[model samples]
Target: MENRNRFPHPLFYLFPLYAIGLYFLVLGVINAYVFLAPISIAALMTMILLPVVRKFENWKINRFLSTFLATCLALSLYLSMFVVISLQANSIYENWDTVSGRVQNTVQKVQESISGISGVSPDKQLEILNIPPSALSSDSTNAVNSQKSEKDSTSKKGETKESTAKQNSGVKAAITNFLDFVGYSLLTFIYIFFFLFYRTKIRLSIVRFFPENQRDKTNKILNGSLSIAKQYLVGRLILIFFLWIIYSVGMAVSGIDSPILISLIAAALSLIPYVGTVIGYVIAMMMAVVSGGETGQYIGVSITYGLAQFVETYILEPFVVGDKVDLNPLVTIIVVVLGGLVWGVVGMVISIPLFGMLKILADQVTVLKPLGYFLGQDDMGSKDDDFLGAIAKKLKRMFK
Candidate 1:
């Protein structure tokens, strides 16, 4: 009888190696699409439009009209969200000076108390705090004396002012850099509109890759991948909305300072995986201290964060996402942390989808099925063994 266990085809090993090489070879070109972001507006529109397109097909509407209506409806919904968030942000900005002063005074008082406990004099505290001597007093006489002393002290002190000004200039420059990034994102969204509008054409082109007999398999894979991408995007949005509601409500009911801002901060941090809540907690507590001028509220904010994370990790994620993502928690965390380290916010946003795509492709490739096993969520028995340990135990038994 023929051996029931068949070795992998000769091409399998070579194909995987070649595929990996090709990935790197075109990584730069691929990164353009992979990192392309729709305007949050255009992205929102795309999500809404996709469903409309499906619904139109169900109703037997003309294909082009269905796509057009979907796109238009999405644009409308996106505009509404834009108006809301923009208005809220602008309202916050209108009272920026008052809010800044309140927060600063609140922090100064906390610093004073902590300095006293640490047995540091106010002068020393100012030095340690690295604030200008001018900030140490409100009285004009003392302020003038401090200024005179600062001038007499050292020319090096004058250098500090120049350094501070340069730092401020650098920040202004960075803002311009960020505007350029937004311009790129807008360009990306324009591309998204065309891709979405003519999605059928893209799929048809991909279909030409495979031989006739294998075309159906290729199409199934294409559809499956698209569905996965859509789910991740929409599901993540759902997760963000739920977090905003729960966090805002908790902060508000607890009488935390700037409950609205706390909620927004939480929503933003929640985008970063594993450690985002910790970062958000620090921010919320700092805001709470300034807003309330109370240590108790600071502690309360921290506790609230701990509770929210507990609920999010144990309750919300499991139930809402339903383990469809199926990433190994360790790998998921490492990927997210690495992404954050590499590219900050943009990296965090793209990491999971990139990871998911890799794992999904691994599952499909015969030679790379082992890689899927390595990255899978299930502990599902592994092939690793310790030969030395086994040999030592066997020798001990023989001696016995």
Candidate 2:
């Protein structure tokens, strides 16, 4: 009896155990994500640059030197992009006075145009709609006026100049943030270095998670995850590059000032998925407006963006991103939202590739096949209304 009890039925408790484990796993990840996000990012970066590291290793270069060189290359690219963006931002700040003046003028012109309509002037429209002017009781109006006067008196009394002190504080805060960012970046590179140096050992450790018989399958999954990360990263970079080129040419043709800077910044912003497209459009329009471009130039830029978006959606993305992820629209949106909620923009950017990796793992494991199918392109739940009907017919025939 004791021997028999040792091999309990799977249906009795296995499913509940599995569910409990999964719940805890997800909870842990969410709670610890701040510490984990950098690790995950470093891993993805390693996937992208692993080949370069390996190439140097193959050439008999020391592993530490190879990793350092690879990290330097990545850092230089990042710093160059940052500098370009910073320059554009600084230009916008310098031009704020002109831009603000133009914006006010544009608004005044819009108001004039609206008021020009004979029967539909704003005052007439409001009158026709029967919306009365906001009116305060005499006592309330007096109270408000007195309050405002008192505030102004207090402001005049306390209006000593401390702009220099404020500036110093702002500089100190910026320096502190820069230092923190540098420290985090240093940690990330160290993580990448260790990952490169211990790639084989890490693979072996991962393989040990499975039974001895399943090590091969585990290794294959690990490799597939790496491949997906590399492909996704490369595809995104190519897309960004193409966007930059298209935006640059269009802005130049439209005679916008700082066209290259505007284009590069707009193109990079386009990496944020659905939200990014709208942002890119707004940024381009703002750049055009601030540069005092003609209305025709604005229309031209819009047309250029529309065509580029069409080409990107219909041609470039489908080919380049391919079916690497294979997540359906519903799952994709949910994960994106969840990622955004958890990690902000970084979460949104990485969610798709992370989901792709999860899908691969789900597909590989037999117990998780149902999840794999759900993450896949199939609509298994709605395969047919006749599915039950077919089963009933088969049962009836067999019983008959």
Candidate 3:
């Protein structure tokens, strides 16, 4: 009777089946990511751009033309940024000699400093690093010998054919990849247009999936999810623009080379949340070091990053983004890492908003309210009157 009682719950028997189904679901998602990613991205893009399309519609523009114009505008902006970044990258490549010299100087200075502190001679340091002392010397004799060897190698007909074949193969592969990217982008835009054009129909179809009694609740959840996603994404875009301006001005003042490129990259990386910020800082510092920046320049970089963080956390986020996502820090980090593991960078970028939508759904369902609560920010009770909270309140008051 005790054994019978222990096995009384049907859920126990179903537990293994549930686990197996979940495992397979995850596997399927990972395997089918190439097809699924575009659809998912289109859904998010539709949410973000729906307002623009609506405005055009109000202006008496048809849905088809409105969607096309919005999508083209987005594509144009992206392409413009890409072109500018590419130009900056080309400039860097053209001056590679100067950059390489600066990098070598920085490395030598560091080695000398290490030798002074560790009582190791510079020559011994080089030996320890597996570098010959002559490696740093720009002796013309070594350059001439390398040129001669290259000429001799090219003089061999077989070697020339082999080199040409490798170059041809490489070029072919690059062209193929570019064509694939173009095709995927075209498909994504098509999906976005359809999603926006038929959004009402789509919503009704989704609602119909639920029982008659629950349809209203399901529709509400859908609207709430869309609102949350739209707000979060739009807020992020505004924040990134501000960050780009701040980073560019600060880094330029600090005498960093290629300030625009560095700032653009750092601002873009800000999309990945906490981890991206640290990575951006590291990249900026490395660029500073490569540019042979002095102590004051290093101090300037540190101050710029600190100021940016302060503004983003206290001022911008509070005023702009608010608690749209409402996800706790622990859950945010976990989902972001899991997303990176599953679908890499794109997954990481979209994870927060997707999870935010899930939280909205969970909150509406009685059985899932506990999971929603677990994913949400803590109330903090009396701690609401704490230091950060007070600052947040003051900011909201001043801004509003």
RMSD of each: 11.2, 10.9, 3.1
Ranking by lDDT: 3, 2, 1
User: Which pairs of residues collide in model 3?
Assistant: none
Per-model TM-score, in order, reads: 0.72, 0.75, 0.89
CA displacement after TM-score superposition, residue 396 of candidate 3 (Å): 3.1
Candidate 3 wrongly placed segments (more than 4 Å): 4-8, 121-173, 380-389
* Cα deviation of 149, candidate 2, in Å: 12
- Model 2 C-alpha lDDT per residue in residues 1-400, reported as the tens digit of each score: 7897696687777889999999898788788876887798888888889989989889999988998898889878878887887887798689877776666556445546777866366555546768532221344456765766554866645553465667889999999999987877778878887888888899888888789998888888898988987898878888889989999999989877678888887777665667778878888887777667479779978987997886576556766666667788788878887888778777887888898899889999999999989888885455246654465445547656
The local distance difference test score of model 2 is 0.78
- Number of the top lDDT candidate: 3
Stretch of 10 with least lDDT, candidate 3? 145-154
Error of 1 at 344 (Å): 2.8
Q: Per-residue alpha-carbon lDDT of model 1 for 1-400, expressed as tens digits?
A: 3576878788988998999998785565345543543443354345435766889879998777777676666556556656666675786688776666777677567678877799777667778768776663346447575666544667756777889999999999999897985677556456546656787787798899779998876776666556665676666667777887777877776666557656866776776677777777777766675565566676666667777776566556545554555568788888897676655666676677667667777777788888877777767444236564455445547656
lDDT of each: 0.67, 0.78, 0.87
Q: What C-alpha lDDT does candidate 3 achieve relative to the native structure?
A: 0.87
Please give the lDDT score at residue 71 for candidate 3. Answer: 85
